[model samples]
Target: MSKVKIAVIGCGSIAQHRHLPEYAMNEHVEIVAVCDIVEERVNKVASEYGVIAYTNYEELLADPEIEAVSVCTPNYLHAPISIAALEAGKHVLCEKPMATSSEEAMNMIEAAKKSNKKLMIGHNQRFVASHQKARKLIEDGELGKIYSFRTAFGHGGPEGWSVDGKESWFFKKNEAFIGAMGDLGVHKTDLLRFLLGEEFVEVGAFIETSAKENADVDDTAVCILRTESGIIGTLAASWSYVSKEDNSTVIYGEKAILRLEEDPVHNLILQYKNGEVVKCELGGIQTNEEGGQTTSHVISHFVQSIISDTIPPVPGEEGMKSLQVILAALESKETSKIITIN
Candidate 1:
């Protein structure tokens, strides 16, 4: 293993815009394969990166030389592919939401344990500099007994972000499982968990396909969460914002009210009760074609975890905690009552 030979298991927008570009930045990584169900996409990304391409993900997983695989596929396929990769003795970095359902997420976690291979979820928000700072502030007790937080991750629509335009798999429920919630909501849920440092104990939420007039899944959703430690919060996700709004996490504590993404308003902001406001810019500031290359940060973390035999920051079970919150939200939306995580 001169260098960690990695394979990308999806050639979609995320692979192109984030993962692959990030891998290119890491001197210790050699991206050996790019896989996708779509032949053209696989070939296109492979050509761009000068790597082998495969229409079948299993083919890439079969490659013994690939020490790790980044699972960038649709939400529905995440568990299956990552589990297979782990079983094949390859470290895995799975995209967020963790899985379409908590059961599936647990299966992936079990597979990682059985194989003793590293499994890291792609909760990139945790990697952002601003978020890292916020986590440190909270852990240091600067906020002092977090009471509540509100956050959101919304955009114009998947069409604007996906290479497939309106026809993107994001619009397909079978491929995406749940639309806006699974796509954007997961990010907020994971971020909230990361910042609060607690698992959600109960959730009550509402979901609707009010916008994106032609979509089958939810275009908007709002959820309320109560963490195990008595912290409360609201999380929102949508594909209807005219201008992208990725703002998030306003934590109110006994000593301070921390507002994230508050100035320039695109960046994270922290406000203290003593009337002090600290602003910090986010990492991976994508101002150009090279902006998304920081995705390698997450990949590098996964590789380091593998080499050191340490659990990943966003490990499978930890990711499952986030997914369980989402699933509880779904249950809450359907039943019109707060659902508990346990």
Candidate 2:
């Protein structure tokens, strides 16, 4: 099979750290074009990857040779760019929190359907080995009727990471839409949905800017969610944690409680009612260019899905479902009441 010629539509941190490197490692992919609003970013990445560079995304999308695109743009541009790419006869893999609003996310999904192209989102947590193993255990009846869950993803802030530093799109309301919840909480929301096999029905949340000094969006937020199956729990996220908390989820079931952390040791720990505890450690599913490494397993899955014409684990609609939870949480915060997903 010929290599999948992919055009990347954002040359930001995520594009550089996760997507680009993963593409370099994948034998079946060719990074053909790179685009960014900032010419310097695109130039640098194109030079590194030996691809053509474009300042305008439309120009990049117009290239018929590109088989797929990775929409790594800001939160506000996700839907429009993805829709355009799909309409241009390219499959799309968008970064998560799929869109700022449910309506926008719906439009992107519809575009993919209309175009008959695969649309997957970057909710990489589902590909983590420990998370995958625990999900299977629950499905296999090992957890025995799961009752509740708690998930969190927090970090210090995007100042050190974003291209524009503290003034990055992440801090701007128009660009980012929502803050910590959209940035990290969305990952947790999606992971819970995937692991628990449930849709969020309602949410009550307190979203606030408690820690990031002069941020226009929330730095810390907490949400309580009720699933379609009546399972309820909390999802917390922050850019305020001095010490970053890598994403983690805990599930309490009738027979046991399952805990998972992505840090120091990526593992699953289960405590049973009979006072027995089991720990399974699975490492190196992901990597960070620096000291910390996260799971890159999702990138491999994306490659496999494209090659096999299989549905990605985090498909467009599944990504939309997760975004709905985050949007619902924001709405819940605004209304000060439980909000429905519809």
Candidate 3:
């Protein structure tokens, strides 16, 4: 097991831009195969990497040569494909919004445990340099008792990013389950939990499909969240930012405020109550725009975990917890009430 052989299950935007490239860069990983329903896309990627192409993920999983796989397919297929891969005795690195529901998420976790395989979720926001720094500062008491926060992730929509453009599964409710909330909101929920070291206890949201016409799924959502420690905040996800991407988080504390990815020059900024400001030029966060292909560190981390036989940084259980917040937000939108997380 010197070089863990791995395959990517979906040859879409995520696999192309993140998983495949990162895995290829990691010395401890060997790209064995790439799977996608689209024959041309899979073959092109396979040819580019000189690896095998698989139109059926089950066939890829049965190869036995592949020790791990990245599930980058549609939202609806995440659970089933991951569960199958785990059952087939392959470690899994699933993308964010792990599943459409808590039951499916728990099932995936159960499969990983039953098969004694690794199941890491791809919530790369926590791996951002600024985000990691913010977590450290909070942990070291730099931001004395956090009070409130506001985080947002907005872009020009997946039509520009997904390989299928406007016809991508992202705009389909059955395929994607939820829209902006599932695509972008879950990332914030996971990141908030990592930075604050707490779970969200309640959520109330207004999820709507106002921006993209002819789409049944939501394109914009605003959620109010309360942590277990009583810290309240707002989380927003939108696909209507026509001008530029806005991936920023502002955490207000008793003594200072921490802003992440909010500046063009500095990725992190700290403002103290004493009228002092500190700007940090930590590397840029990955964006959908050109030249925004910053390394996400997810694939590298996953490979390291598999090689070391250690639990992945963003394990299935952590993914499920993060996903619960989005599920609660969806419920809140439907009920028009604040939903409490169990």
Candidate 4:
């Protein structure tokens, strides 16, 4: 196929602001279909992108023209929809959190393996330039023996980002399956795993609804994670940052402390033990609280994987590993004890 025919299965805020726009810009991709339970939304998105709109995602998935499909629906539907798309012989680019539970995520991974299709998770945090640079720095051994790291992702709330505002599915336990932890914490877990190149073996967490008065889901959470390599760190996710968003990571090392997006002006900063500070401004981090998640390289990588017939950098199995950490965190919080990732 000269161009990959693609369909976006959710015409919500993320599909509108991120996936659709990115697909429009990708020359190798053709936006063939758009689907949503909301007919009005599906129509609007299809009209805007000049594609077919379907009220049911299954109808869109049945179309033989579409070579790939972006599963941008609610968290609970992620696994089922992505698995269906893969079984239909279409590559799937699923939105983050991957799924509500590790079992669902594993199902999607297995489906992709059985179908021999590309299954890329939309974990945009890993595609940011600053994060890429940080990963490179750590890989190059500039930070020496890494002692520990702290990563945080905070914003106002999903009320400000979701299409339905306060009534969105994000705040409902039945649909969302998780609160801020799944929304933002999963991203941090994925990023830490990517930067450190290790899997989290255990997790201890404190999850509570400290803010967002109208929401049933958690607004703030703090997780203590220990990786397979014996590295420990704090991963926090919050929707209570009324002042500003703090999507930053600081890695403590024997030689230096590397900070990513800690400074508003500088994208990265390396503070050495011997009184040396190196500041570098590469590009802006692609994560956004107000539904503006542009300037991300995730779509490009997904498309490249299709064109090259190569595995995506963040494939189904990779995303599943990240989701497992958050799942363990959830289990730990409920039990009031540390949970091990077996």
Q: Write the per-residue lDDT of candidate 4 for residues 233-328, one digit (tens) a residue.
A: 999999998888899999999999999999977989999999999999877786654443465787889999999999998998889898989889
Q: Against the true structure, whose TM-score is highest?
A: 3
How far residue 178's Cα lies from its native spot in candidate 1, in Å, is 0.7
Clashing pairs in 4: none
lDDT of each: 0.83, 0.86, 0.94, 0.90
Q: Write the per-residue lDDT of candidate 2 for residues 165-261, one digit (tens) a residue.
A: 8878898788899899998899889889889988889999999998876588888999999988899999999888776555778999999999888
Which segments of candidate 1 are over 4 A away from where they belong? 265-268, 281-296
Position 114, candidate 3: lDDT: 99
Residue 232 lDDT in candidate 2 = 92
For residue 68, give model 3's deviation from the true position in Å.
0.4
* lDDT, model 4, position 318: 88
Clashing pairs in 2: 285-295, 285-296, 286-294, 286-295, 286-296, 287-294, 288-293
**Model 3 stretches with alpha carbons more than 4 Å out:** none
- Lowest summed lDDT across 10 adjacent residues in model 4 is found at 286-295
Cα error, residue 46 of model 4, in Å, equals: 0.9
In model 2, which range of ten residues has the least summed lDDT? Answer: 284-293
Per-residue C-alpha lDDT of model 3 across residues 1-342, encoded as one tens digit per residue: 478999999999999998998998898889999999999999999999999999998899889889999999999999999999999999999998999999999999999999999999999999999999999999999999999999999998999999999999999999999999999999999999999999999999999988999689999999999999999999999999889899999999999999999999899999999999999998899887888856999988898898888999999999999999999999999999999999
Model 3 scores a TM of: 0.99
Error of 3 at 261 (Å): 0.7
Task: Give candidate 4 misplaced runs (Cα > 4 Å).
Answer: 289-293
Give the deviation of candidate 1 from the true structure as CA RMSD: 2.1
